[model samples]
Target: MTALDTSKVSIKTSLAACFGRNLYEQPGAHEFLQELSQSAQEVNIQQGGYIFKEGDPSDYVFIAISGAIMLERSSPKGARHVFAFLFTGNLLGLSEFTVYSFSAVALTGATVVKINKRLIQNIFERHPKIAKSFHDFTTHVLHYVLDQMYILGQKTAPQRLAHFLLDMDTRLGRSSGQFYLPMNRIDIADYLGMSLETTSRSFSNLKKRKLIEIESSHKIIINDRAAILEFIDE
Candidate 1:
């Protein structure tokens, strides 16, 4: 894939056209992004390749330009915990405060844009709206973390699985009846705090109940929205 020059007229025009007021017309958004594009380097990561490890210096924030990125943490007992499965337009490394708390690894062949901390800080200082946008993004992330904690702590396997799918549909905007599962079953299990077999069985059970339909392509179809909605209560 060709690298994007953030300053060029073509990229700017396309971004302006695609985003309209949300991007191009926003206060300092285009300028900050243009500044970012000047230094943003696109890097490719193969599936399973690490973008960064836990405890590493938080010098850079990465934007997922393409494919999915997995944020993972390992427990003392060596259990893998998936913090998130980030897709296109998702930002990583913003919540770490200083050092990376979780490792960012590629769930698939991915492309990322690396932005240094200095650049971000400078832009944020100049653009109050941009800073507020970042603040809002982090706040949403915190809420998501709390929601996951509740699911893992109190929800049963089926409930957790149901909640996970619903949340994925909302976050990924995959409400077109089909949602793709890029991460493997093991990763889903880890994310949901269940065993791999349990996670797999949950999917099978959902299919049997006519709540969802799973395809070999890793695509899932929500057959009955009401049934899926009431699953957590049951």
Candidate 2:
């Protein structure tokens, strides 16, 4: 973990970004943000550094201000599952229990703002609109997880890879149909529940079919978006 010089990064601004523009524009949003900023602390994490481990005290929630964070869990036998990769504006560390259910690590050098969970809950209690917006945000995350569960359970290797690419494009692509995969093939395999070789083979297969172009190990260009969609649908 590295200490961040947060003089220029506004905690309130980061919070507003994570919570979304709609919530930031809500009534009493200013007061809510002010309270949060007063207690928020920004931390910079080096790539692969742990943000919080599974079973750690869930005393704080975090907002990614920059870079990427990987949320994952490991079983007692050492089997691992990658839950999700969080980018800028993503909220994390909220749990239903006293301890974190999964671990968060910096997928890249990352900056995150941390706020005391108890303070946030108290503020939410006083701000019904903010609470509703937060509920909606969390529900949306839940839906994404459920969708991934379905894909992993039902999709074939190629289908799963296609879905993953499309999903990544939706989250990280530019207008040019290009995106950088911050994670490597092994990470993709772990997230998709496929072997690493299968994941790499799927990428090659897609490139061979001209549905996508792999510029490098980390860069992808969607050559035929429509065809890729059709492939997934088939």
Candidate 3:
């Protein structure tokens, strides 16, 4: 790992900085991230680079600073499935069960803070509160995963897309109402377990229903939030 320009730490750092105060308030979280700040190194990977491969020994945990990484699993037949999109402040490689159940690959130029696993364990041991915070974090992640499962397993294509858009809007909102998206249809398709064509068609349907408007390929305007939510609920 190389030294990063401290002045230009990415959104991951911003997220950490914004939440760091609250994180410190959490049980043992301050000492953990502080120690982690000392030991962790900032590293960058190019788009499409593998951060860690599936089945690799879990040696380090990653905290995304910028860009996005996909956690994916592949079948024996080589068919690939995406599991999650890890954004800034997301913890990587913290599982105590399997070494790594999926591969983490950069979706774009990515920066992450890499912390040694041993150091993480030591921090957790020294502060049981740190362990509890981690536990709560993982539990929240699990709930999000289950929600993703519900979207994939039951919803129609358009509904799934609506749900995805709403989720992105909610998560990335600037003033809790407006948000801009960096990901395109293909990324959404891969995340939603659908084909790109289907994803595109879903957007078309949403536009036709006046639920959202595609200002451009990379831009969207959600017209009726309530209607979109109702559609998703159905």
Q: TM-score for every candidate vs. truth?
A: 0.87, 0.92, 0.85
Q: Rank the candidates by lDDT, best first.
A: 2, 1, 3
Expressed as tens digits, the lDDT of each residue in 128-164 for candidate 3 is 7656666777777889989989989999999998988
Window of ten residues with lowest summed lDDT in model 1? 12-21
Give the per-residue lDDT of model 1 (tens digit) for 1-234: 345467655445433432343565568886777676677677889998999999999999877767888899999999788878887767788653778999999988998778788888888788776676667767777898898898889878988998888777765655666678788899998889889999999988888878888877377877666788798877
Q: Check candidate 2 and list the clashing pairs.
A: none
For residues 91-144, what per-residue lDDT tens digits would candidate 2 score against the true structure? Answer: 999877999999998989998888889988987888888888888888888899
By TM-score, highest first, what's the ranking? 2, 1, 3
Model 2: how far is 120 from its true place, Å? 0.9
- List where candidate 3 sits over 4 angstroms from the true fold: 3-21, 26-30, 175-180
Task: Give the local distance difference test score of model 1.
Answer: 0.78
Worst 10 residues of 2 by lDDT: 1-10
Better of 1 and 2 by lDDT: 2
Q: Report lDDT per candidate.
A: 0.78, 0.84, 0.76
